[model samples]
Target: MEKHLNIPISADEIRDLKVGESVLLSGIMITGRDAVHKWIHDTFIDKTKPATQEDLDTLSQLKPILDGGLIYHCGPVVSGLETKQYRFVAAGPTTSIREEPYQGDVIHFLNLRGVIGKGGMGPKTLKACHDAPAVYFHAIGGAAALIAESVTEVIGVHKLEFGIPEAIWVIKVKDLPVIVTMDSHNASLHTSVRDQSKSILNRLIEG
Candidate 1:
């Protein structure tokens, strides 16, 4: 049987992936943005506080949680207690490019193999896709309620100090279907469509 992970995979698997294949991701996905990225690198990577080697391992391996996985460009809603098993309200995509600065480093460091979002990522992330063989998956934007269903569980959270909208959340999900908007071969649908449109426009003008 094909092993389909539920959601939020692990760091190691993300590094080893292909261009056009589907996966059912499972495990814990950490939600964050520019602020959270800065926070993680500064605090977690730098060991701002004392942490055991195992803790550091988990921290660095964060992105692979989505390896052969999905990355929601979302900032989720925190409507429950901070206990171990609290489910949040709605989690959806935030602009992915804001992560450009750290996405490459994060993917490189954690072996990120996939990402899902509304507006796709930027150049650095694109290069990372080439270097890392990752794919940028596009999820249905504005479908917060539907998206929530894919999330089977909320394992917990981290760095709540960054606060909501920019915190590192541990979210678990399953059987999430997304489109391959970008691929490891450095192919981009957005650019392809744009070029096709431009060609059609020029042809019409010449005729």
Candidate 2:
């Protein structure tokens, strides 16, 4: 069945998704990469003067922008800097496994319901998805320009100090295609494929 998921999707909606299911997502999603993730993790971890309240307040303000929000692992090529108007030229998924160390904590802290990225995350993120009622959507690789077509507008940005590629870009999308590779129910198509492939290889070796 085809599912069209709206941004800020409710926990119930996410929980209902199954691995290998295709979804056309619309609404707002934030783009973040390695630097952004690290910054978020570092900012929240500083016990001495950690500005957690400030960060939480920022997310609070953004919550309405996307209720069941999605975080995208991407570094987009943006144009129109002279006019201070940003246009997405290309936006593609980054390797999700690179953020595995901090993804779980970020998802929990930010109350994010979905993640769009390439490759699959590890046990920590998988466990976090189940506990936080979140899911992982795998975007098509080598489809940067194609994916950018879905980005209707750039709403806002955070942490520009990290540079454009690493900054958190708030973008509105329409009918962006993705696959539910990992679901809130702790089901993972990535893991299933890997295990199945391994088993097949073992059988061939034995034969």
Candidate 3:
């Protein structure tokens, strides 16, 4: 099934999604990468150390936007940095598996309804989706420029000290295309593919 979803997607909406379904997402989304994920996990989820005032302030700002919303695993190529007028030049999805260690905790902490990225995540994140009633939306790899066209506005950014690619960029999108690779029911296309490949390899070895 193909569906169009707005930001702050409800738990019900996320639960309705299934693996292999197509989704066109509109409204707000935040870009998060390695640094952002680590920060979120350490500061909010694990509490490995105390959160500084700046960390608390950043969390306060993100909580409202992330609650029941989507997080895109992107490291966008940006322009106009000198003028402080940022624009996404190539907003491509990054390798999501790199975030496996932190994604599950971050999702639960933020009340995220969905995640957008290329290359699906792992079992931990799949379990988190089941618990949180969220879904993982797979964006097309190597279509950075085309995807950027869907971004309607750059709302703002936070934690720029993490560097441009790792900063949390709040953006508004219109009809950003993706596929449901992982869903709230604990279904995962990535797991299916991996298992199928393993089975095929086993058969070949046996024969």
Candidate 4:
């Protein structure tokens, strides 16, 4: 049976998932990448410099959007600039490793349940998935248009000053295909794959 995940997913839902399960996601997902991740971390978590009340307000506004939602690591190609009726030309997963340092903290802070991206994350994220009751979904890389076809609408956006790609994009989608690479139980298909590859390489070298 094909698994389908909906937005505002619960901890129980995340816990039910297992690594390597194919899932089709329905409902809303927010697009964000390196900059968005860093901004959230720096503004809220790090506090190297005290954030202004304005910054705090901005974060507050975004919090509800993120709670129990999915974050997509993607920078989409968009059309309809002049008409202001935007359409996704190409939307594919970005390399998720770049957000590794921030993802766990973001998920915990925002109560995020799912993340969609290309390359899998590491120990930190696996631990966070277990801790936060979340999962990481691996969308197929390089199938931009195919993936975009599933997106039903561009609901809204934020941080447009960061430019289109870097800005946070809210999109509605139906049955967007992904694989559960990391699950709420702290299992990681990515780690397994990497370990197996290393073992194979070592054996070949010894021969």
Candidate 5:
């Protein structure tokens, strides 16, 4: 049977999803890369000073904005020239494995229910998926031009001082398309691929 999920999904939710299936996502996804994660961990979610409503809202909108939303893990290109917009605009998915170390925490920190990126996340994040039942989805890589069009709005930004790659951009999107590679119920193509490869290796060694 098909299962429906709520915002800030747990690992349990992801486990049930199948490869190449569709899901309706809702809620916030905080954008970050290596330096950004370090900045956020050092400055926000892990801080002693509590984040104010504005502090949180500056870069994040609540459920109405994200209710049935999906987050794309992308670092975009900056026009870098003097123009109306002097920051990054066109974005492409980053190698998600780079985020394995912090993906789960970021998900939990933002109360995010869905994650979209390339190459997939690792164990901690996979475990987080299991715990939250949130599915990690994937989209065709190198398709940013088509992808950015999906962004309905640039609601706000956080830590703009971090500049470019390290800043958090909160984007609103609709009718985005992606494949379900990782589901909250504890299934993963990464694991299935590894398991099959290992079996082949075992057979080779036995022969």
Candidate 6:
């Protein structure tokens, strides 16, 4: 099925999605990657260290935005950085499997409805999607420049000390195309493909 969705997607809306569905998303989503994921896990989920005032402040700002919202695993190439008029030159997705350790917890903690990235996540994230009633939206990997066209505006950014790539960028998008590769029903296209490939390889070897 093809659907057009807006950010701050409801849990019910996310639950309706299924693997292999195409979607065009509009509205706000925050960009996060490895450093942001690790920080969120360590500071918020695991509680390995006490959150600083800055951390708390950032969380306070993000909580409402992320509640029933999407997080994109993107490290965009940006321009006009010094002027603070940021524009995404290329906003492509990064590998999502690296976030496997933190994604599940992050989804639950943030009340996230979706995760957008390239490639796919693992069993942990799949289980999280089932439990949290979330979904994983797969973005195209090589179409960085093309994807940037969807980013209508840069609302703001946080944790600039993490550098441009790792900072959490809040953006508004229009008609951002994605495919549901993992769904709240515990379906994962990635797992299916992997298993099918393995089966094929085994059959060839046996023959």
Q: Which candidate number would show the highest TM-score if scored against the true structure?
A: 6
| Pairs that clash in candidate 2 | 8-67, 8-68
Q: Roughly what TM-score does model 1 have, to 2 decimal places?
A: 0.73
Model 3 agreement with the true structure over 110-168: per-residue lDDT tens digits: 89997899899999999999999899999999899999999878889898999999999
**Number of the top-ranking candidate, with lDDT as the measure:** 6
In model 4, which runs have C-alpha deviations exceeding 4 angstroms? 49-54
Which residue ranges in model 1 land beyond 4 Å of their true spot? 1-24, 41-71, 82-85, 197-207
Give lDDT tens digits, candidate 1, residues 57-162. 6565664464544445678776666454567677767778777777776666555666777677777888888887677767667777777777878776666666
**Predicted candidate 4 versus true structure: per-residue lDDT over 82-174, tens digit per residue:** 786888889999999999999999899899997999889988988999999999999999999999999999887778777888888889999
lDDT of 5 by residue, 88-200 (tens): 35666777887777777766665556678888877888777767556678766888776666555565566667766556677655455567888776778888888999999
Residue 147 lDDT, candidate 1, scale 0-100? 72
Instruction: Give residue 71's error in model 4 in angstroms.
Output: 0.6
Question: Of models 2 and 3, which has the larger TM-score?
Answer: 3
Compute the lDDT for candidate 4: 0.89
TM-score of each: 0.73, 0.89, 0.96, 0.95, 0.71, 0.97
C-alpha RMSD by candidate, in order? 4.9, 2.4, 1.2, 1.4, 4.7, 1.1
Model 3 Cα displacement at 107 (Å)? Answer: 1.0
**TM-score of candidate 6 versus the correct structure, residues matched by position:** 0.97
Candidate 6 lDDT by residue in tens digits, 1-207: 569999889888998999999999999999999999999999988999899999999999999999999999999999999999999999999999999999999999999998999899999999999999899999999789889999999999999999999999999999999999999998999999999999999999998
Give the Cα lDDT of each candidate.
0.66, 0.87, 0.91, 0.89, 0.64, 0.95
Compared with the true structure, model 3 gives a TM-score of 0.96
State in Å the error of residue 180, model 4. 0.3
lDDT of predicted model 6: 0.95
> Model 5, which residues run further than 4 Å from truth?
1-16, 23-30, 45-70, 78-89, 198-207
lDDT comparing candidate 3 with the true structure: 0.91
